[model samples]
Target: MKESILLVEDDSSIAIVITAALEAEGLHVDRCDSIAGRDCLLASKPYGLMLTDVMLTDGDGIETLPPVRAAFPRMQVIILSAQNTLDTAVRASDTGAFEYFPKPFDLEELVRTVRQALGALDGSDLPDAAEDLGQGLPLVGRSAAMQAVYRMITRVLRNDLTVLILGESGTGKELVAEAIHQLGNRRDGPFVAVNTAAIPHELIESELFGHEKGAFTGAVARQIGKFEQAARGTLFLDEIGDMPLEAQTRLLRALQSGRIRRVGGTEEIALNCRIIAATNRDLVPMIAAGTFREDLYYRLAVVPIELPPLRERADDVEALSRHFLARAAAEGLPRRQLSAAGAALLARQPWRGNVRELRNFIFRLALLARDDVVDDATIEPLLASDNAAQRAGEPEAGIGNAAPADFATALDAFLIQARPEPGTLYDSALAAFERPLFLHALAQTGGNQLRAAQLLGINRNTLRKRLVDLGIAPEDALGGR
Candidate 1:
């Protein structure tokens, strides 16, 4: 007998494509577009699997999971949705969903998931929904990449296991750390973040473990370190790759014993914080090079979570850009909307700087463009200019053999493609560029204002003044490197 599957999706085009694919796989597929229809289908016949989208004509598909499982305990449920957010994904997981697929998903993957779900159709304890996950999520995106990250975060929410977040700079590694801490068992406790790269090598030990008064030349007063401050909470060791070897040894000892000795104190202190470490650098190579301790790497990476760069999740660009634009408007920047053409343009960029780069670019667009609707015209000019800047540093090889200089032509095509709605482009382009330029320099210099100033070829005082003028936090100016 063929196993029957129920698919509840509102979009007809998606329904047709999915139905055709499932039919081709030799499984019986029953299509419905609403919760009501799904109910009728369920009551009439047995189904091995139910693949449903969150949004339906009448009601949410996920809301039916509890009831469906109660009635048909053996039936497996899988949620498919365009609403790709952590909340939606978590909720789907909470509903004992066999799997969750964010749309514009691959049909082949969907078929594969369906086969797996059908194969596992049996009575099991359906998990209850997680209530009140949190108020704010620093990370946003519904891409498969982000969904993978969310699942890992949920698994560690109740446990105190150490988490190592690995990603390129500007990929929101700290945001993942924050989410883990905020959504974890230690939500009530203090959350302390220490940028090991920003600290001098000599002070690394003193920073992680407090020092006794008069313990060292700078220890005129007794100081409590990050481990103590984050007791029963979370200790986020940002840029863990930059920690000195000596500090790594002490850190490993503390992780093993769950205890730390103050810099010069004879007494030992028991640490009770969940440790979350993040680094943009690849630690495996560092360990192989003996720059980073192998044992410490294993200790910190009990559960490793790698964040996807923006280029890898191009489907999420439009949503993320809108989110940032909304945030900018809420923070008193002029309100704006991104035209479809503009969003498509953004989705096409390499975004080497990743989310941080896209965010800053959006802010610049919001501030500089005179139009309420930012379309290709407004975006193309800026992108072209940026591409030119990035290309300027490249070594010139040959004239005819070189890549064609089509930046302006591309911009012109983009302009012709869409007419942006007029708004206000009154903000100075120089001012728009100045803050990010200085901030990038600061990040490259590891938040040392003097060094960043030197790199930018500006006076230290001038850099400080610019930082203040731009309302950029010293910590944030580092791009959370």
Candidate 2:
């Protein structure tokens, strides 16, 4: 007996192709152009599976799925959409779809998914629609690399699995964590983020697991740690690779036992939060070097998602450049539109700093560009200046890369936006320059103050004093390493 399948797609061409492929596999594929036609067919006939596109003639295919699922509880669903953003992916997952295939997906893979859908057509629980996922969708790009990431994210949206995101700095790891939290089952609870590497080795435990009054020199009262504060929610541990060995032991214990005790308290408070960890460092090498824990790595990386660096996805640069330009305008920067040549030129750069560097470049372009529509003429001068600065010693897009004219423009903008107190302008300006400078030095030395001092060609005592004066902790800057 051939199994029946319902495919509700508005595009006649795509429908023909899918129907031909499925019919060849000895399956009966019923095609429809709208949700109303789908309902009429489903009411008259039973189907082993249903494959639908996101957009139809009458209404959104995904939005109307809940009612269809209610009436035909046993039929499985697979969604196909041209909308490739993370929001659309999450929305598809919210409807409890058996699988989701973004446009330009592999036809073989789609056929395989259809076969799998029919083989296991049990009544799976339909997840409640996600509420208020927010307007801010940070993760962008529709490259095949990004599609892989989106699929991994959807797999974890309905569970509390510990997710470990791996990528170079500025590859939007935090944004990935934010998406999982906002789209996952625990969306109603708070999302608490703690950068473990930013806390001093001596204080990491107290910061994450709380501390009773007088537990340490600076413990003035019973403070809630990130673990407890994130109760029934999610805890995002950024830069997990930089956590000290001593703190890593304590973290492993908590994960193993599902409980935590304050630094000086007796009662073991049960942990009740989903943990999402991210680090740019390659942990396999770190594990062999006896820095990151292998056992703890296993626990954290139950489902590791490696984000593609910008160099690999240069195709997405134009889209990302325009996205950043729009955001810059919304944030009160001059409204600028990227030209075709301008986007092409951007796509050719190595983008050593990944998306973070590209975003910074776009914002600067929005600020300094001469014309409303920026072409290569507008972008070339800026790139030339930045390249000259890079050759002169600074990393790509560093503070020291600014020319005298560029420096003046930045200072003028700062003056306008900061509105510094008349008497404190010099002090404030000096502080602003020194903060990134010191942080850059500390980062190059891997948090070793002695080395950072040497790197900056300054006395260790001077470096220490300046770090304190500027409130720049070695841990804070060293996280990027």
Candidate 3:
């Protein structure tokens, strides 16, 4: 006889489709709608495999896993849910679910997963004990993304493993490192942070491993490095991608041998500190390009934790905004609360700078808004001003015959020196130079597009077209003025 499969799904349409699919595969399929109904079914017969949804009519599908596991330890369980958050994936993994399928899943993939589960019916892959990540930690956000990060952090706290945190700039890579140090067994030990990118390339080795007096022409006095300072503690290397390859070799050696030789020093110092490295850049690409060392990358990335960009975690925006606003108020900025519309406005923003950008914007709102409650209207002008300032600072390829090279030529040279393949250079340069110029001209003329056109030496119709193309409303220019 074919093995039996139990499917617990609330949606009748989904159940019909899944049942048909499973039955077509020559397996006996049972269907139910809730955890209670599942318990009833489980009590009656043995199921070779179980597929369940997270939200059921009577109770959560996740709550049914324990009892199902307890009664049928070797039975394979697959969790299907509409909730596609990082937290949900982590929770499913913790609960020993064979597979997790987000809503709108591919039927072929589901069938494949089911077949694999049926072929490998065993409990050996599940954890002996599920780790308990304590509630209300320093990291905010109950978003699925944040929950996954929390789970990974808690897993590494008990061990002295080197952790590599990857994320875009300003996404709190440093904060994650700090949390690891604070929560880990090394809580009492000193937590030292060093920005590898900020330090001078020539002096980085001396800075990390210390130097004896008269080691070099500039080394007049004996100085202890970051490693010695962070003895029996945690050393956080921030922006580690920017470290020179020579320094990476030294770092890799130190990590391998658990010892470091100071500059011009004969004896090797024994090192006993946990290392946590963070970077916004993708090191794999750098490794391929020969800019970063592969061995060093492996050594640092033993336990990798990637932070989600702020835009990806939209559910947490309001909470993070409020947190920043409250902090600004406590620091003597005018007390303020975000209006519902303002909160929604924050949630909708792209937030290219991530959490740091959001925090700074909140600080600006608290400082600028006169009323206790900040609204969407109050935020618009400030955003315009901030955007205008950023645009104004961008390199402008102004038309000038005084120099031998034209604007584009100069830009090409600059781009070559910065990096060879500066993608979308022409359009970015044009937009950057045009925005502030047009906005400022319009603001000076009281939002008069015609007058702004005259001042900018462009046609009025052309100015109008540019404004429309740039998504700049006339009201923003007026408000900014």
Candidate 4:
């Protein structure tokens, strides 16, 4: 049972750093960008701690505190601000703030405070810190890569930190942003998502900063941008890598000053919204190539999270396949189970499109398979199409000198030439191949089963069985005599 935290902050950079640190400590965090968002989160679920900022887009945090305390007496509240005045601290404390910290505060101290707060709540309630990423949304997999990400999300939720999610397209970058928002202090706030790449270059600024009535030819009425709509909540900037250089500068200014001037409006409105930016492109390379701003990259990547591609976490395929199939069935599609050969086939393929593609494939497979079980016959054709696409994209080195670019293609060719029929030779050969692979992996990790399991993306128990099936005794796996 992870302790839940609520974080209310407007700075993207700060939110990222703080969230990363707190999550690393194994606490569950939720974020709210404004007072309204905070209120909504409070109304939905009870949190162990409430960390809020002094100023917000809609209203001040001090004004929001009393209502929150009145509603939930057990909830601990803390105020974070750039204002370091003695008056502000004393007033906030008097108004029921557990503590007040100035900007650039030590994140370690914040974690300590959170632990103490949780400890004070109930002696028996402190959960085992080592439990793998506790249950939450569609984000599954207990792989070390995912565990690290989960930890980062936990810490940042305890404080207002900006988050930069770096991953390839279809790897669920937006899902990560939603998780941060849903699990953080502002779970009740609106999760407004904006794709910077999708917006026209000319209208990017107006779309972000809102537009006044009659501001442009098509402006029949005043229109609020994502920033305002996400006030007291989260603003997810998807495809942020494609934001123009000019827009980046304006964004930097807004992040720094916490102010936004609407298009054709002189009034500079203060903003308090948590910012989560996701991009498939590598900002570092872009910065080096002079396309992306280096400063903005640093600003957004305070708590950078890199999501691994599906191929990299192949161990998760069977689990994810079953999960997707269940979801499809729930949605009125036929329920399907993967045959042993089908699961093996899925494991061999390189899912270039990552989780999203895998999910779509599962749904399609479920719909197509006449029987309850989806076997290799149903999987091979689809896998071949993906393999063909990959080979077409890759440059051929030579005739026989270069290997097949796609693993599925190579596997298909090997199985056909070897002529291993389904139940006997084919199954035996695969099990033989998989066993040694698992044993060798364990050996490489020096018998650290947990690490080996994570590296292989399978549970430890599964790895243990592979060692036994391969007849590689535990001593051999441990590199013993």
Q: What is the lDDT of every predicted structure here?
A: 0.82, 0.86, 0.81, 0.75
lDDT of 4 by residue, 1-481 (tens): 3378889998878877778888998888898788889888888888888788888889888755666666676777777876543334434544555556766577888889777877775322212121222244777654445544654565565445789999887888998888778766566889999999889999999899999999989988888888999998999999998899999999998988999998888889998789999988756655654558889888888889889888877877887888899999999999888888888888787787899999998998888778898889988887778678778876433222234323323444545456555556557557745765666666667878898799778998987776776777778766631
Lowest lDDT 10-residue stretch of candidate 2: 126-135
Task: Say which prediction, candidate 2 or candidate 4, comes out ahead on TM-score.
Answer: 2
Compute each candidate's TM-score over C-alphas.
Answer: 0.69, 0.79, 0.62, 0.56
Candidate order by decreasing TM-score: 2, 1, 3, 4
Q: Model 2 residue 26 lDDT?
A: 87
The TM-score measured for candidate 2 stands at 0.79
Q: How much is the lDDT of residue 467 in candidate 1?
A: 83
lDDT of 2 by residue, 262-328 (tens): 9998889999999999998767766754557999999999999999999999889999999999999
Q: So what's the TM-score on candidate 3?
A: 0.62
Say what the RMSD of model 4 is. 20.9
Query: Candidate 4 — what's its lDDT?
Result: 0.75
CA lDDT, candidate 4, residue 460: 86
Model 4 lDDT at residue 186: 66
Q: Which has the better lDDT: candidate 2, or candidate 4?
A: 2
Which predicted model would earn the best lDDT?
Answer: 2
lDDT of 3: 0.81
Q: Write the per-residue lDDT of candidate 1 for residues 158-263, one digit (tens) a residue.
A: 6788999999889999999998887777989999999999999999899899899989997999899999999989999999988889999999999999899999
Off by over 4 Å in 3: 1-4, 11-28, 54-71, 80-91, 98-134, 137-164, 175-193, 200-203, 206-235, 255-276, 282-289, 298-340, 347-350, 371-373, 395-481
